[model samples]
Target: MHTLSNAPLRTVVWSTGGVGSIAIDAIARRPDLELAGVWVHSPEKVGRDAGELAGGEPLGVTATDDADALIALQPDCVVYAASGPDRDGGAVPDYLRLLAAGINVVSTSSTSLVYPPAYYSPDWRDQLQEAATSGLASFYASGIFPGFGSDQLALLLTTQSKKIDVITVTEIALNDHYPVADVMMDGMGFGRPLDFEPMLKTPGFIEMAWKAPIHLIADGLGVEVTEVRGTLDRRVTHRDIEVAFGTIPAGTCGAVRTRAAGVVNGREAVVVEHIIRMARDVGPDWPTSEFDATYRVDVSGDPDIHCAMNLGAAEGHGAGRAAMAATAMRVVNAVPYVVAAPAGLLSSLDMPNTLPRYAFE
Candidate 1:
């Protein structure tokens, strides 16, 4: 067992995009973590200070496009937050290489790795396991929805249930402000023709993307999921709406509703649902929250339970920046526990409770 020590853990920020930029900021600010090095994929980012890339003051640590050079720094942990929807295939090999080099990793790139064995092939699972064992490192994958919003928070809420019957976790977001063009336009079908099929509607894609959270909840409840199923639907915009990313023309795909359910016996006992909209009016009939970004949990049992969490900006941060910070902090906060954990692919169930490093003044 690894013991807590006075020396800060040497850490590397694997990418300087979206969540990766947030990780760099958090690591540089935290007193318990040392910003060792940064690995960047873009040559333009090469030689830039990690702090500048993260939109903060210079931290003296230069970002490198060379993966091998960052690995040579011998970082204790790597926060892998590379863009996943389009770059997942390459991200896996990067993770494997990092783990093999004795560097623990916490990532938001591959949601499947939240509970890897549930979605990954046995060969892939064994390879990751073997690599971790050989290098004495650990790898944990998580994000906002799959990490805390659905699996972890739902499980934590269920502890209050006298006799739990069903648990449903939902994420309702007005995604117009989110600035990922590929994910918004191509990946999710937003701003696309109504007849055009997005990747989310592809058969088995929803199940593959969400099975980890379903399995995680089921395992926590000590129930065997008989099967996993999913449904997808979309709504068109009635009028043109301008968003931070781009414009959504009238009659284009503007909102999406998807549900992935895990069946235990004959009932959909565990469920993860998403109601994502580019504009508020696009899906008036669908589920929504008062806040722009909200996570909700509804548990049906002897005494019914309902919980809603709103995520937004701090005093100086914008809503978009706060959301990204929350996502990055989820994995960043887990670093201490992950480093202290035994070498392996750890799920939420395996790790100890992770709290913020500097919550109180």
Candidate 2:
């Protein structure tokens, strides 16, 4: 068993993008962690200081596009927050490289890794396991939705239940202010024609993308999900809508509703639903969040319960900013636990309670 150390862990920020920048700032604020290096994908970001890139004061560490150079630094953990739309083509290789180099990794890149056992590809899991074992390093993946809201929060609430007939975890977000064009437009099929299918709606893709949490919740509750099923619903705008990334032309896709349901005994015992809108009015009939971003969990059982987790930033900041920071901080805060974990892919259940260490301010 690995023991926690008093000395601050040398941490590296893998990207300076939305989530990665937040990780950089949050890492610097933690006393148990020290900002050591940063790896950037954009050439423009190269040679820039991580702190400044993250909207904070300079921290003396410069960002670079060199992944090998950052790995050579031998930091305790790498906050891998690079985009994961291409999970296998991109994120998996980077993860393998880091794990094989004896560098522990905590990532928001791959939501599928939140529960490694349920990852769609058994071959990939085998490879990751081999790499981690070879280097004696640990790896973990998480974020606000799949990480905390969907799995952790839902499972935590089941503790008070006398019987759990069904547990539904829902994520409702207004992404009008999110600035990632590729993710917002191409990946999610937003601003596309009604007949045009997005990657998310492709057969079995939703299950692959979201089944990790369903399996995790089932395992935690000591139950089994017989089969995983998915559903997708999309809506188009009647008028052009302006957003942080770009404008969504009238009659283009503007909102989406997707769900991954875990069936047990012919019933949807566990379900994860994502309802996202470019404009608030697009999905008026669908579920809405009290805040711009909200995660709601409803448990139907002996004692029915409902809980809402609202995330919001200050006046100048948008809801996406708060959700991004929350996502980044989830993995950033797990660094200590990841560093002290056994050499392998770890889920939340494998680690002890991770508190916001030194976050008393």
Candidate 3:
């Protein structure tokens, strides 16, 4: 959508998932932005007010599914919650069109993992990149995990230490209740027996997702990774556990354990451990049916330091629709910076902290 050079950000949201809804709620309470409208894929929600989907009374904005109608809104920015096929690997293209149409954008689509699409799918990278620069529009993709927990942001934040030591990040959560189909396959290591330990080198099924994130961290931290290793635990059919998927043994977890290490000039200094789920993985021996996460950072520097940090998000991954909705609104709150950011594939670490402090309620 087009915007006058001086007007406040006119933000349009493309979906009302969990995170998107939360984000919309944030925007509904903010006075700096105009909640352009809401868009959805299903017709059932087409006429409902965005406030209802979010957590408010009525903003008068109705949900619609037409992409063209959304672009016609001429919003200053767009928050995308749609992923993969819903937009047919075309959401990035839509963002480019929005920029070319003079609207900045932010999204949580996994595909936007890194802007310029070239990083994952080159189908529309240059087109979007060109528009981002020429149109002076912003386009960003971020998530609590890959977007923030991965390299370029959280990992890079450790560069201020005088000396170097070890870095370990673990994302542990109870994930036996998720029901999405697409995620069931890619995100959850389904298909194998409910009690199988996923092979680390199966070629395509390992939790190797940490490689790029760790590599990015290592490279930025001045370390050279000689090799990366990943391990996966698939729940196997057993006699002790019983669910819709049936019984599962203890030797396996529908989880992936990956570690990426880098040797720095003969001195091994970089290591990353990505513990996706612990119900049957790393923490299986500790607890079950509980939501928990911990991030550990240990660096022996000038004064030598060791810190262990944990964030619990077990109820549900905020990104799973509900989380994205909240984060989307937060993204809307960061419009100015996301727009003013340098024209390129920008990382959250590179993007200055601009959003207002989130109150812990």
State the number of backbone clashes in model 2.
Answer: 0
TM-score against native, each model: 0.95, 0.96, 0.75
> Per-residue CA lDDT of candidate 2, range 200-262, in tens?
878998888889999999999988999999999999899999898889999999999999999
lDDT of each: 0.85, 0.88, 0.57
**Which residue runs of candidate 1 sit more than 4 Å off their true CA positions?**
1-4, 313-318
Q: Which predicted model would earn the best lDDT?
A: 2
Better of 2 and 3 by lDDT: 2
Model 1 lDDT tens row, 1-361? 2456998999998889879888998887788999999989889999999899988999999999888888888888999988845656878788789889998999988888898769556677788888898888999988788788988889888888888788899998876667777888878899898788888988998987789999999989899988889999999998998887789899899899889999998999899999898776778999865566789999999679999988884222344565677789989999998988999899999987778897552
Give me the overall lDDT of model 2.
0.88
lDDT of 3 by residue, 1-361 (tens): 2333555567887777666676677666666667888888778888999988776788889888887888888777787776532443557667777777767787777433432322444556677767877877767766655445444444555756766666655444443433343453334544344443333435643324455455556656756667555544433323343322443344444454555555555654555555544234334543232334445555555545555444445454522343233345445656767766665455454577655633432
TM-score of 2: 0.96
After superposition, candidate 2 runs with Cα above 4 Å error: 1-3, 313-317
